[model samples]
Target: MGLVIPFDDKASDPGLEALVALVAADMNRVNQTILARTGSDVAMIPEVATHLISSGGKRLRPMLTLATAALCGYQGEGHVKLAAAVEFMHTATLLHDDVVDQSEMRRGKLAARLLWGNEASVLVGDFLLGQAFRMMVEVGSLACLDVLSVAATVIAEGEVMQLSAAKDTETTEDAYLAVIRGKTAELFAAAAEVGPIVANRPKAEVAACRAYGMNLGVAFQLIDDALDYGGQAAKLGKNVGDDFREGKITLPVVLSFRRGNETERAFWKRVLEKGDIAEGDLETALATMKKHRALEDTVERARHYGSMARDALELFPDSAPRRALLEAVDFCIGRAH
Candidate 1:
């Protein structure tokens, strides 16, 4: 029998409203910092950067930094700068990712690469990384700087790893996990860890925040992978079959390919490996995933990580921030429905 995770009808909002309310003031500062930093004498730099930055994204990673700092009772302005830095790092990655993937859409708008050529997109992404590091240096916390800098390196490595594994039907689950850890979870971990570090929290609390963010990031990516196959385009901010069309080897593809029969495996090899996708290939892929319960099991795996994220916060006391953090996990996992 397949694993079954309960879906809550009320999880529609993913508890983000509470988190937004909790971090409202600090987030405003972060936003201001972002807008100020994006400006440049080279007009194209701001033009390209603003196009994507202004696009509709939840700003969840930076929000994680702010929320974690609040949870740790931080009263300094360092968290605001760090939050803005985290957002810059994330935006840089998206700009680079769209160029690498040749993706046409991001956050429900034309990808920056599409609007401003790939060269401009890549250059602007570099500019953002430069700004992100500047903010980190200004904070003057070597420990926080180390965490975010290491995350930036790891995120780049993860992207390279994914590039190597792209469209390889034989890619293992371990390989995929390693990729996500570097590309996605590392930033989340760093974003969450820097908060407690700046707040001068206990070592255990710092470790707990790191663990929570890492697990939450993994869960968030897993749900995104699942959503690529089963979610709506409007809700996903991209075409429903974008991953399929791109020949990206996400978890659902890995699971379904492994569980498929000889004929089905050949079908995957043809579309994913050989890039011979034809009409109805996406439908067939989705059907194959459903037949093997690949999407459902992928979500079950996400629930496992979500549980770990919640448990990571057990060391913290009961508070609004803690509650909001816990609810954020539910929101990540519940987006599948």
Candidate 2:
């Protein structure tokens, strides 16, 4: 079930909006940087890249970079370039993921791979990745570059780990966490940590920033996993059973599989491992998750990590940016509703 976050009867909380408001000016600069760097003489590069970039993603990771850097009293323009680099990296992953998954849709429209073909999609993704690294170098901070470069490698490893784990019913919660930590949290931690590093903050504060982003990223991905089963397709910008069809062993699937009986396990193996999904299979899967409270448990886990993210920010003094970042943790968990 979607977590019903009580927010004065509002459909959604104002936390992300508040965070966006706090970083509006900096975010504009980041957007400008992104647009400027994405251009290429080859028409297809800009076409594919701009199609995905113009999609209505919230750009949360880059905003985190800007907010964290400002929170650390950074006065340099490096944060803008770093924020743009973070966005490019995220976009690159999306392009690569769609191609690997053979997904038909992205952000409620035809995937670039579908429109432009897989080879173009992969090559454009590589172009974005190269541009992301070039921007990282322009920042001129070896520490920042180190963090993001390691994140890039970790993200690739995570994609591979997920590929291997797909359709494998034996995947554990710990293994799933490791996959998401690499696939999602590494960039978040690097994005946040780089802020403090660029600002020349102390080690402890930088560590705290990294901790905040890591926990927040975990919470973000956990909520996403929950929403795949509970969320509306329109809000999700894809079909509800996309994950099930792909046979990806997300947390809910893992929990349901582990708790299921022999008959249920057979059902999972038929549908997931063998990709023999038929009519009513998704409904059956939902019923199984509900029976075992898998979806609810997954959302609860997200709340736990969100709490950790908030707690990590305790090292920072009270300020508008800090409040927004704390609210972002709430927003990340709350969005599942």
Which candidate leads the pack in lDDT?
1
Q: Write the per-residue lDDT of candidate 2 for residues 213-309, one digit (tens) a residue.
A: 9999999999889888888777778777789999989999999999999999999999999999998898899889988889888988888998999
Q: How close is candidate 2 to the true structure, as a TM-score?
A: 0.96
Give the per-residue lDDT digits (tens) of candidate 1, residues 243-268.
Answer: 99999999999999999999999999
The alpha-carbon lDDT assigned to residue 281 of candidate 2 equals 91
TM-scores for every candidate against the unseen true structure: 0.97, 0.96
Off by over 4 Å in 2: 1-12
lDDT comparing candidate 1 with the true structure: 0.92
What's every prediction's RMSD, in angstroms?
2.9, 2.3
Worst 10 residues of 2 by lDDT: 1-10
Question: Which 10-residue window in model 1 sums to the lowest lDDT?
Answer: 1-10
Clashing pairs in 1: none
How does model 2 fare in lDDT?
Answer: 0.90
Candidate 1 ranges beyond 4 A from true positions: 1-13
Candidates in order have lDDT scores of 0.92, 0.90
